[model samples]
Target: MPTLEDRLRNCTRSAVHLEMRDEYMPSDPRFTAWRNGARNDPADSDPERRPWLRLVADLVAQGVEVRRARIVSEPVSDYIRFEHHLTVPTVRAGEQVRWLPRRRASGLALPGNDFWLFDGTSVVFHHFAGDGELAPDDEEFTDDPVVVKLCSDAFESVWRQAVPHADYTLA
Candidate 1:
């Protein structure tokens, strides 16, 4: 099986990420630091310091439109607030981001898991545990047309209703 990096590298047109969880990877050092009131310097775009930012930058440079949408619960979690604060560099790196309050997502048929859809073809599902940590054997990737269509449609639906990151606030 091709690695996720390999798949992403081969993506030509778009890479869309849909994130629905309120909290993620609590044990992650970055989150831990945020929990302690630490904040990321918006001026820091050093790929060495943040590899994911590097990836998003490279993909955008390649003309791959990278976008992310988060459906968050209102009275947002601390982690979500921290993520919003850190999103500046991510947007500056060229990834478009939006936030959707979960209450507004009532009628949409969303997927069971968060996922990244590449070029409308491949999908990478992120499974998480009850505590919101990534599942032990997480990252599931597939090219099934059915799953791809569902995720693609779901993402678009959410994106259309989401607020652009800069305008969103925890309510």
Candidate 2:
């Protein structure tokens, strides 16, 4: 028989026993997929990702005095009108707001298989293994998945490359 490591390295279609979940809660034990998105990628997009809507509603609901920044740009440039609802607040909702300045900022680095996002909650870092290997169970995963580790390292490198936020004048 092949070594256990070899068997686990190619977990292309295996399932692990785990707690019942939302069936799409991400972090599912048996899910074997990866992509370039936030650390928290729901099977369907979540409204919580729309920080702009939450901000506006929160401002009106809580009536917290809001000084705003109104510049939002996505280097990917893939967000649509519905997504823009959140993009606006993400662009404008903080005492200290900063957007990822990839295509615009001077000295921006090359795109890698990693991304970092801060939503005034905590810094979330995402690293994807572009080598296209499926992630095995934490209990069963083997191969050290060095490509994924490298992706995580690349995320740290880019986080260091981030520029400080500048206030928007909202012209």
Kindly provide the TM-score of model 1 when superposed on the true structure, using C-alpha atoms: 0.94
User: What is the per-residue lDDT of model 2 for residues 1-171, given as tens digits with 9 covering 90 to 100?
Assistant: 343223322233221111111122234332333323333344223437644445434443443332221123443232312233233444343322223333343443233322222212111222323332323421222223453344334334434543324432221
Tell me the tens digit of each residue's lDDT in model 1 across 20-116: 9999888877778778977665435667788878888899999999999999998999889878878888898899999999999999999999999
Task: Report how far residue 69 has shifted in candidate 2, in Å.
Answer: 19
Error of 1 at 32 (Å): 0.9
Ten contiguous residues minimizing lDDT sum, candidate 1: 38-47
Give residue 156's error in model 2 in angstroms.
Answer: 1.0
lDDT of each: 0.89, 0.31
Alpha-carbon runs more than 4 Å astray in model 1: 41-44
